[model samples]
Target: MAEKDQVAARARAVTERFQFGPWSMMTVKSHILKSEGPTRERFESQLELPQVPEMIFADNVLRVIHDDGYGIEFNALDALKCVDAHHDPLKVAVSQAWREARSSCEHINDVVKPFDWTFTTDYKGTLLEKEDKKITVSETTERIDIEKLKVREKILFYEDMLLFEDELADNGTSLLNVRMRVMPSGFFILLRFFMRVDNVMIRVNDTRLHYQAGKNYMLREFSTKDDQVKEIKASQHLFTDPNEIANHLTLRKEVFEKLQFPETPPEEGS
Candidate 1:
């Protein structure tokens, strides 16, 4: 008990000393005695690995927990490596974390441009009117002004969140909007995307990827309305197949890499 306490205390000190931005201090616990049973097997099968990646837990295999409830099990040296990867410790914790994503805003823009395709948003409003001693409810949609569309992007260092937002105006009034937020960590990222496709259609996606653990989950909500008629639906999905995870991870790595860096090489260290 005394030795465990000492190790945990020391680990906490390291995280607190160097942690930055939305990264809060972490709690550390020894995981040396825990059995690698069903969890290990499941992880391997989900990743479809002929053999599990090497598991090297030094004298003290530790479980480190972040403020957002995400955690990982690894050794002290490995833990520090994660922290050094541009403040994204998970990069070292999970090999796949270092890879880039397959698709991104740039890709979408490029593809659509070549095809002469563009996206638009609509605004919907409801009104109640009296007619012949009866009350009638009606909905109206108006197209937003393209010439006045606004776009903005920002990054939140403290919360590890990235945001991209767009808005359009109709007759000097707000008509349509879209917002996207990305919260990323060592093992996965939470992507929250919502868009009002004009007043007639709305789409929302909450996607969470546990690539390291091979747990991929997504929640989708969509609604469409035409004057008096409307349709809405929502669904969720989880995927753990190893092959699928690999493919998704590969594509994700590609897209993300393009966002962070360019193909051109940098000059030698300054």
Candidate 2:
């Protein structure tokens, strides 16, 4: 038993030496850890493989919050080469946290779009006679005073769509989700038409990545609720699937008049 313990310790020492703490920190790291488990144990943070490419890591603080919620930080000095995670146990912890932060930001877009609408209707003054609908013509011949028209301002929003990529974690798939917040620049407008998204869409390299709307991911209330990623959708090639690719068949707007409002939008007119 003593010899065995010595061997193990020696091996660990060799491994640590292999990981060059003396070397320096790496510029950037990134990754996506998808999960399909329960909410409590969902997506395990993953170290961004060399691919995700986060330039910010080169000049930013890497922070990791364990399950306990205590934050652990990794400093990035000018010589960050000391960050070889191969043999360093702490390296994995620190790298995973930074990677998750960067990767998790991908869903900031679809999740933050419009939600509801409010505005004053163009109503003529109330009178004894029934209100007659005014037809909106191309151009009115008579000059109308702008002051006379009722100025009813309204805000509009819709249920947001939380967007994410398909990947696997030990617990479940991690679905990147975000809520729409007011644009700081347009504070006066509030949640009105002046809204601007602080975060943009994550560039999904391949739409061929197969993910079912309800199965792989679900969003009941994008702003206040969490989304569940049920499965890891297999990436499929749309070009090879003749039947699947036909949905994009373009049709003229005139042909779609029979379709309902939400079900189908009129194709753009020529």
Candidate 3:
């Protein structure tokens, strides 16, 4: 009884609105499919949604509908994981999914439309520190090699917003960190990508996009540490063309692939 009450209280807290620097922010977490248009029919007809199991965990799933026709459709058992385990498994999974989605969106222009996909990240930096003090300086330097270093990533969600972070480091120094956030309802995306080497900024690309009713425009501010910042304005038509919808679907596939967890460095003699 106490657990149930606690979870109910938590749900309220998570759904409540909070003040943010003279603005009010809603924290309602939604799991419904969303698109930038006047109606949900437009989104449904244009996009292909993933087929979630109807009977998850050998039982029927549950749907929670909101007044605005958006809601979370999830397994009752899985939903109970939040209260039973005292942690939000669903939130973690949703965040991971959105992270992949944003990655796909980032690469969409390259694969679908004509655009450059080059990333200007400096590799000459220390990212992780050595634990062993007895190790020689040369050994430490070798351990901090950029190509040999692996990229680390994490995804987190706050209500309706999702944040994805991809970082690469040399030794203990930050080489690059790209942080992206996505809002499902508003079709909004924000990205802050930065690269540094030896504490010197190498490149930065800060971008934000909000898809309006008929047309969508993205603003990108690009810069190098020593160079002046440059702005790029890109726009696209929403929901009017079939080709655009197909391109968006391809982007989703690209991002959704990450959730499948592809094997890294396939084994020999397969």
Candidate 4:
């Protein structure tokens, strides 16, 4: 009972802005696919999402929904290990799924959306130090290495999640979207999906994740029920295409048809 209570307590403790900031990061490399004939070249501008989630665990998976009605299933383990090699027991304990509200999400552009903001955080770890009789070091030494310590990234895509207020968005939104290409030197590929937000708080197992696009949107307890930072539901969530998140998958029209072709029969058959 005590262990279970501790687990639950730790789970509840995971809600703060940057709960698992100290854990190591596993980099994720995503392959992409595109269907539209307009092959896009040139490196698109990258926007530094203020914070990206730092805690994605082993064997855990997340289904991402973008505004374009596209959905992608993210294997937290593969994304971390394959991309960066995520390996930390504490990360699993502290990190929960995206658990927050789904409101106050701003839009960037009609073609571009932003989401998958882990969060920006700086955490510290400690190591024991030993000293000789002459070197009696009773105090703890502290240091900060911003360069290699924690890595942050922003995940962007186009989504069906509508932006009612045009004033809140502009053309700048397209600059930060995720880029998927076959060749590093050839052409860059752009895929459409949902989840355009400024920041997101995700708890691995929880569903009510909070995400907001564009920095500094309205955030109030009343914005969502139960005082969650964001509210998440099917109606408000934008989907992402899983194939798009994976760089290996080609975004061929036939591929799209295979993944999401409706049951509608051909006119001739009807």
TM-score of each: 0.20, 0.15, 0.20, 0.16
User: Against the hidden true structure, what lDDT does model 4 obtain?
Assistant: 0.22
Over 1-270, each residue of candidate 1 has an lDDT whose tens digit, in order, gives: 357765764664322112323223232333322135543444334432122112212233322233343433323233222112222222232324112211222432343212101111111111112232211212212222223222332322212222222331210111121222222322223333333323222333333222211212111222222110023222111122221222222111111111001112222321
Which parts of model 4 have CA positions greater than 4 angstroms off?
1-56, 65-72, 77-258, 261-270
Error of 4 at 153 (Å): 19
Candidate 3 local lDDT, 97-172, one digit each (tens): 3234335443332343221112222221111122321111111111112231123322222232321112222211
True lDDT of residue 79, candidate 1:
24
Error of 2 at 180 (Å): 1.8
- Candidate 3 regions off by >4 Å? 1-185, 214-270
Steric clashes per prediction? 21, 30, 9, 60
| Model 1: residues with Cα > 4 Å off, grouped in runs | 1-160, 170-188, 211-229, 233-270
For model 2, residues 1-270, the per-residue Cα lDDT tens digits are: 257754653453311111111111111122222123231122112321221111112212222121222212232221122222223221142345324433544432222332111110111111111133111112112222223222443322111112222222211122222122111111010010011011211111111101111221111110111111111122234322223322222211111011111223333431
Candidate 4 lDDT tens digits, 1-270: 257754753454322111111211122322221222122111111223322222222222223332322223333222222111122221232333222212232321221323332221111111112231011112112212223212343322212111111111321121112222112111112222222222332111101112223211111110001111143332222212222222322222211111111122222311
What is the Å distance of residue 254 in model 1 from its true position? Answer: 19
RMSD of each: 24.8, 26.2, 24.4, 26.1
